[model samples]
Target: MLRYSNRSIFGIMEGATVFYTVESNNVTNLHQFNQELRNLFDRLRIRAASDGSSRKFAAGNSTGPYPATIYALMQCTPDLSKQDCDDCLVRVLGDIPITCYGKEGGSVVAPSCFLRYGISLFFEPTDDTLQSMGPPPQAVLPPESNGANATIINEKKRNASRIATIMVVAIISFLILIIYICIYLRVMRKPIGNSETTDVSSADSLQFDLGTIRVATNNFSDANKLGQGGFGAVYKGRLYNGQDVAVKRLSKNSEQGNTEFKNEVLLVAKLQHRNLVRLLGFCLEGSERILIYEFLPNKSLDYFIFDPTKRAQLDWARRYKIIVGIARGLLYLHQDSQLCIIHRDLKPSNVLLDAELNPKISDFGMASLFVLDQSQGNTRRIVGTYGYMAPEYASHGKFSVKTDVFSFGVLVLEIVSGQKNGRFQIGENTGHLLSYAWENWRKRTSSNIIDPIFKGGSTTEMLRCIHIGLLCVQENIADRPTMASAVLMLNTDSLTLPFPTRPGFFMNKFSESYKESSEFIQASANEASVTDPYPR
Candidate 1:
């Protein structure tokens, strides 16, 4: 553990400000490249402030068989002690990118630590450095045994046992010290408050610093804003490595349970599928709770499917692919994933598309988990888009895998019709998409609800999807096909579909009087996001 005393020199250097940064541009050996840098850094860390006089520190990985050699040096003012010098260098190393990221040669000279590196040896050998550095291996030595090389001395066999003992003891001591240091750092940097983010540090390797995220997101400016969601807004970002990412920043005063939302998000992160959006990592600093995801260039499904000009881009092939892709994603969540997850909010806006137009299910803020044997659960709060909620769920606060299946059904209809279910235009009557679909199905004019522009595709396949969609939205829970069955039906052309009864949201306008306030939205016949007034 590092304990900087009050009397400790928290001082900076006034001289020796110049440092020669060295690295090789032609080095193609990745293993050797990284090893050289690490070896040099490790050596520097060991010698940092260790020589009593904090004036000079030097290290290099020039002895390895690899032709590419990496050299480095860090030094502070001679007045500072070893600890102060070490702390200063440590702080510099913390910001590796600012000092040296991809450059082959660079120098970072700060008041605390002066760092320098280059491809060539820039510093001459000094008597103190040569004496302090360890002894060089003998010219004659046996070939490596299990990656270990031994030098040939007059009493090689005699000193072998002693050397082995020394190595073992050093390794053990180093490991113990590392463990102690890790525990101390974890305790020091641990999140404050009741700690909904206690387990967050377990994935610290993937965690991005708050400062780094802010820089990548351009301080969450309006230009970088993707859009607002139930809890907050999503922003597009590009990391220092040129990797694109999506940042979801939750509203500070959001009414949703911060701890519960994070727990579910962490659970969903373990889920891996081509159709499901990848959760990169999260940040919890002060009042900020942000979830990072792999950036999707094409944005959400609603972005394309809901727009007049963009809707035309979704050819029949793409639309069908989206439908099947979403089905497979749900199948993985409900059955294939490590845990059974019910996506409480599976609307078009939450389904993101990669560059290839492939669908990936995103936004699990409303998702709930269940065990393999646990099929159904209830909640006092009904949270999900209105048009997609299953009858048994919105009214009674009960939900299951079938609830998601009901939602998937609505998504299919929306994709096929290019219209939202909540407020589909129907000759100025302002009817629900599900009701218009059912009326068309009953009147033997199923094609009426389909997007007219999406013609020349397989007529039979299109009708079959509508049939499956209707089956999914059936008022009876038992009547709705499971995701497994729905996928099978979508992939199989010969599968017969039973007649679909009235979908849950059909003629649901009268139920608005029973609406409860929601964190996402309020209720109205003209529009609805998380409103389901059913109270049967």
Candidate 2:
């Protein structure tokens, strides 16, 4: 049987659909069968609806003489609230009399809950269930003529056998655990590259021969070139195994030296997350330093957000997803990863998108590794793009996770407004993107900062993102939210955000200086940074 109700689950407003089935045969003893099934259902329901429990599934059998046993299972969708799960199961259970009462076997399936029962076992017993059953009833040996003495001797023998078996298993388990720990330590401590030199010969497994890369890129032909950055040019290449890869061939005279190149290879290879780009391998032959990465078909965020025609393709949903993705990626870098990394040069161009438009943070050349306990660092040379740079870092060379947070804020604003950070112009009014967003936000006209293309998008979500962006770009370093807090704000709608302070570098005071500085950096060979001027 099938039924539909005007009740919703999992955010779909269409309602819930339920399907049920029952065996043709009926139990001989309806009272006993009903009692057993009821007990089983109660047990399974409690298991699936228990508070603070991660498990949403339960299965077991009830003993009965009428049909020997009744195996049953209950399951609820993981996202459903405990109360919702109980209510759904209760409604489904109420349908038993009408659909499958006294039947030998039956099943009810719904979007949020499932119920199944049979005369025979239909599912594997889980470990918990097995443990609940305890060890199988010990084999009862027939009493010998010696009676009590034989019984005592047999019990002692069984005890000794059990103890010996347990000891053997314990020893084997300990040895296995030790072996695993040793293997883990060896892999964790494996040398990434030569500490004395930039050569990565120590990481033989991740080394790619120059000949292979040359063949893949067709001897560095211009046709395969993807784009040029501060470090070098990237090329689209096909390996011998039919896998497409992005090959980054470093420029010999580029600002990124052997140290930065080695750093990129080491950091990227060890780091792995869905939001971060995967580094496949690298080639270190002669003066050529090439790094291979998984090719992302959609290219970088800048390719779409900055282009008028392409920006149309990114609706509010995709834009919000990209913003959230970048936040999670930053959170992973700053906290979740083994090394607390600060990607000093985070910008739209460094945020690559895969075929599905999922954001993946890339380019670790300017990233810094920080100890878990370390909160900040200083450098004499201030690197990274101008508009995205935090006020403290740009002026005082003080950087921390907040530096990346500042850049993320700018990127979020850009995504929401579909405008670049350096110069934001709307009609006669013109200023930095941060200034524009803050001005409108302060005036309760935050909708003005949203892209006009998003005609019917969620205004509230866009405004919230803009608010988060402002919070990130606060002039005071301490005022900026950490990536973790930013991520929480983006995900949780109930979170009440604190009032934002003035953003760093607000207004056009530094507009001329920023432009001049950007131009100078672009012109000067030694001062040049990877801006990724062209779309990938």
On lDDT, the leading prediction is 2
- How do the residues 1-536 of candidate 2 rate in per-residue lDDT, one tens digit apiece? 11234665452221132356799987888768877888778878888777764656677788656547788877676666788777777767755654576688987655567688888876544354543233545555566756877778668866765664576346434544554565577668756753323234334446677766786799889999998876778999976435789999877764456555565566558778999989888877678878889999998999999897999888889999999999998888778876677777888888999999999998765343343345677777776777788889878988878888999999999898898886557666666677778878889988888888986756999989999999999999899999999999999999999999999977643456645544432231233232111001
TM-score of each: 0.62, 0.59
Give candidate 1's error at residue 436 in angstroms. Answer: 1.2
In angstroms, how far off is 60's CA in candidate 2? 54
| Candidate 1: regions farther than 4 A off | 1-201, 254-262, 366-373, 426-430, 508-536
TM-score of candidate 1 to 2 decimals: 0.62
How much is the lDDT of residue 456 in candidate 2?
76
How well is each residue in 108-158 modelled by candidate 1, as lDDT tens digits? Answer: 554455666666765543433444344644465446642344434334654
lDDT of each: 0.68, 0.74
By how many angstroms RMSD does model 1 differ from the true structure? 14.8
